[model samples]
Target: MTKTTTRPLAELQADFVRVGALLKQAREDVETLRRLSMAEAQAETLAAELEAIKRQMDRAFADEDKAKEDAFIAGIKDVRITEGDQRDNLIRRTFTVAVTRTGNDGLRDWETTAEKTGLTSLKPEEYAWLLRHPDRIPASILALADDPRTAFQTYFSSKKRGYFRGA
Candidate 1:
């Protein structure tokens, strides 16, 4: 024979309500966790996309800068002159002169007109000495300096504008 213990209906009903509330709270917590996980995933994806866009922008800026540099280099004329002494096989000299126009009055004035013949590398005293004794300079180099083409017919013919007006 078994003996059964029974509680009041009100008490049992209150216990059921409490269990139901706990179940609901557990479900809400699970839903919150799911939302948090989804948000973290979305943030990761957005961060990757932002990084990709930044890389593309960086590459674009680099390309633009390279193009500008190439254009500027193209504007300068590089003239190469080689001189060799027949008497001595080892005596050979090469000079590369970079010429460009100057002043705001078109290409009428040219900077480095005489100094562009590789003489700009000399010290002030050495240049003054050369000025006093021009015969020390090679005849071919002097002839090149005397050429009209070396004066006004080189590259960078346009006058500087905007930020480079005085510079």
Candidate 2:
């Protein structure tokens, strides 16, 4: 291109004004992008915080429900001792099996006798095994039983007057 002569002062001023307007538009775009990015980051942070709060609320709800259930169970202690199914679901057969493996024939004998007698199992022999092998039972039952050491004793004590203890 041919070199032009120097522009008039007014033309130079107009060129500078156009350049300034372009620079200002570029700056406005950058500022808008920055604000959008920061807003996105803030929104992500808030979402994460809300998720944490939801988890906490779930845990608190579970704890509250458990406490209410415990209270409800604690209030119903009166047993009228009638002739019905005294099911013991808490006791597990693992205790009896462990006892059998340990060569404690007493528990095996008791299991055989229970089957031989007219005993239709409603909840398995877990409770009976726990009663016989109280020492070896799981720690989860520690608070549930009347006495971890003498749960079987208490059970046997509650047996019919004319009934003999296990074999």
For each candidate, give its TM-score against the true structure.
0.34, 0.29
- In candidate 2, what are the lDDT values of residues 1-167, reduced to their tens digit? 99989999999999999999999999999999999979988999999999999999999999997686554433222211112232533321122222121223555522222122111221233344443445554443344457754644433343424343441
Worst 10 residues of 1 by lDDT: 153-162
Kindly report which residue stretches of model 1 are placed more than 4 angstroms away from their true locations once superposed.
Answer: 1-31, 67-94, 102-167
Go through the candidates in order and give each one's C-alpha lDDT: 0.51, 0.49
RMSD of 1: 15.9
**Candidate 1 TM-score, true structure as reference:** 0.34
For model 2 the TM-score comes to 0.29
What is the Å distance of residue 112 in model 2 from its true position?
32
- What does the lDDT read for residue 67 in candidate 1? 79
